[model samples]
Target: MLIGAEAVDTAVELNAYLARFGYGQGLSIQQLWAEMDRVWAEMGLDNRRPLGSQRIADFYAHPVWVLNGLFADTDPTSVRHRQAIAAFLKDACDDQARLRIADYGGGSGALARQIVDRLPGRSQIDLIEPFPSDFFRRRLGYRSEIRFHDVLSSDGYDVVIAQDVLEHVEQPIALAQRCIDATRQGGLVLFANCFYPCIQCHLPGTFYLRHTFRYVLASPALSYVGAVPGAAHVLIFRKHGEIDVAALVRRDRIARGVGPLLNLLGQFHSQMKTLGRRAGLSE
Candidate 1:
């Protein structure tokens, strides 16, 4: 059984390094725990438990679908996504700590566990979620060396996994920097999400997914609609050293009306897979 973390313990555990990371105030363990309790009940979720001291949060739904989701969608079942995530973690792991991973905001640990299970070799995984209800669940196994942190104040990791957590943040660059800092000088920070820094769509403004709970410092709400992706988790990627920004650009130019058409094509392919399944053919 995992030895559950309480509010006070969370404060004591993270107090030493909290100041170093510029995490700001209103992060007392007790405060976060209470916030978790209130938020879950408000969402109408039945299960309740003390939030662990680490900065972990709720079980995420985005990456779950990518890794385990059975839904019919584009890249819904990612053999490539899992393979890519494992490759990223392996590339960032250091010899000093057997792959010191800082999974910030990895609430359910499903992705972390998935990566761990796929890797096969021994490695340590550290989860950082800041909700009380997250800590009390029986599924969160306890290990002396492997554990969770309410917040990430200390640095020195081979890989910092922040899948689907950036768009939700109030300060995207600062958030990216935090992950970069936790990473060793040459380590990597990998993340992803539905929103990008730019908007290719004709819509007047960009949008973000709505959180049922009012987040502590996440970006202030700017919309009334559901997320375009509709998944609870957004993924992020970080690297300790400078990233080659040039690679992101595509050499090919789109025709006048190709963007939406390209998107439609992606959807068409997704439906094709569903059609195949109905035909009793494996995708």
Candidate 2:
């Protein structure tokens, strides 16, 4: 929804703009959709419905979504998205001679490329995406420093990036814990562009707030850095020593119990607002 510059004077300027952030090269949404249509025709598939109508199952089963760039387009790409990511990267990669970075649920390896470009020294990066497109994989093959993984490794890293991933998962706390566990002591964990509603497979409004992520930061294992809230909020956490597993489990239990009640309340409020608007009693 956050569109960037619609027009550029020259290809050179556009390429430089993209390269400044290590985006490498990518097609416009129009071009991406055109390619998707071709792929759909070739596969003899015809699901032309809007994104909101598409279910989570369809997203995973169809390569058209991931391979043709629909999945890539869902990421927040506004000026705010770039600024937040840049600020986090500056702090996380500062004064590092060598770094190991993990991008959890990294789609198309965009963030991995950014990390490699931003960091000053030798870096090893891993992109953990469960449903990566062969197209994207081949595109990223030239970067020997970046490796793709279907599952997260048990090994620790200096920085872990889980951008816009929590809202999609069934159990956010579990996923957050995995990111924390993979980070070394005093290492940074970036959670940017998260807690936003998406067309497919996002948690309810009750769990899409800054407080919902507090459970992870409250753990003995992590220290809160800061947050920048916008259409997509960015939250940063730093790992301490080993996590207090028992405390984390207890917090998750509480969240699960309270989440549904909060969701119901939110739904009630939304319905009331809609009714009021129809009655011309509210703006």
Candidate 3:
């Protein structure tokens, strides 16, 4: 497994960091997990209701996400995932004299900072987060290698990462296109999407893309580079140039045609697993 000692330590210290942000006041992990649902209920957010773009943007600015983000990033699975991302990045750009990376919807900037330390070449990372937590600004603010951006810059980046970001957006396709658009030709776009309804915040609208994301986002301009080793969720792709609109439309049609069967099988599997547990067949 690809490991970043410093990043792991930083994630381990998130609970202490949260203390400064007015969280972790005798709060347990379970309570912190429930915080997002609690906020959703307080806001009267209906999962069935689709939020407008601005509303979605504003909702993400809430402080509850800081707690959620800290825990999520610190989880063992997430730490490994970031390690995989860093490994792929290193393999792709290690030989280059300079590297430019953009981490879209990157919550804590931990991954970007970790990359800074691991890469030998001079590198710059732009963290595209609309509402960076106070801890993030305070902890990484002095790092000359990492810069925070509320909006993605038009500059062509050598690598663009959007890990677990598309599921929260109203128009994931639009954002996915933007990720592709921002990359330099032959540069990499790394994506780790969770399109399934695994969490309350993952919009139901995106569930259609759960099985179809790769096909839907397929473009002639983007050559499929395969998934990151040991972390299958994170996909690797190399950009060739401007996206072909006709090819995109065709691929979207293909996804729409094929995704429902996969979704149905997935639902059936979940239902059967739930039934099995209820009958005490398995844990």
Give the TM-scores of the predictions, in the order they appear: 0.44, 0.66, 0.81
- What is the per-residue lDDT of model 3 for residues 1-283, given as tens digits with 9 covering 90 to 100? 7759986776667556567545544455567657767667677776678675225554566666776666555566666777877877788787788899999988588688668878844789999997776567767878888888888876899999998888888778778888888999989998888887655788877777888888877767888899998799898999998998777877766776777778999899999998988889654
List, residue by residue over 178-254, the lDDT tens digit for candidate 1: 66667775555565554432311111111221221112112211111222132323333334353232321221112
As a TM-score, model 3 comes out at: 0.81
Winner by TM-score between candidate 3 and candidate 1: 3
Give the runs in model 1 whose Cα sits over 4 Å from its true position: 1-80, 91-97, 135-137, 142-145, 196-283
Among all windows of ten consecutive residues in candidate 3, which has the lowest summed lDDT?
Answer: 20-29
lDDT of all predictions, in order shown? 0.45, 0.64, 0.78
| Backbone clashes counted, model 2 | 0
Per-residue accuracy of model 2 over 1-283 as CA lDDT, tens digit each: 5434543343345345444433423445455446544544554432333334445444543554443233353444543464456456666567777888888877567666665666634678888887765556777899988898988876889888887677766667778788888998889887764453433234453263334457535866688877744324667788888888888878777766765666568779989998988889644
Query: Residue 19: error of model 2 in Å?
Result: 24
* Between candidates 2 and 3, the TM-score winner: 3
Query: Among all windows of ten consecutive residues in candidate 2, which has the lowest summed lDDT?
Result: 45-54
All-Cα superposition RMSD per candidate: 15.2, 10.0, 7.5
Q: What clash pairs does model 3 have?
A: none
User: Best by lDDT, which number?
Assistant: 3
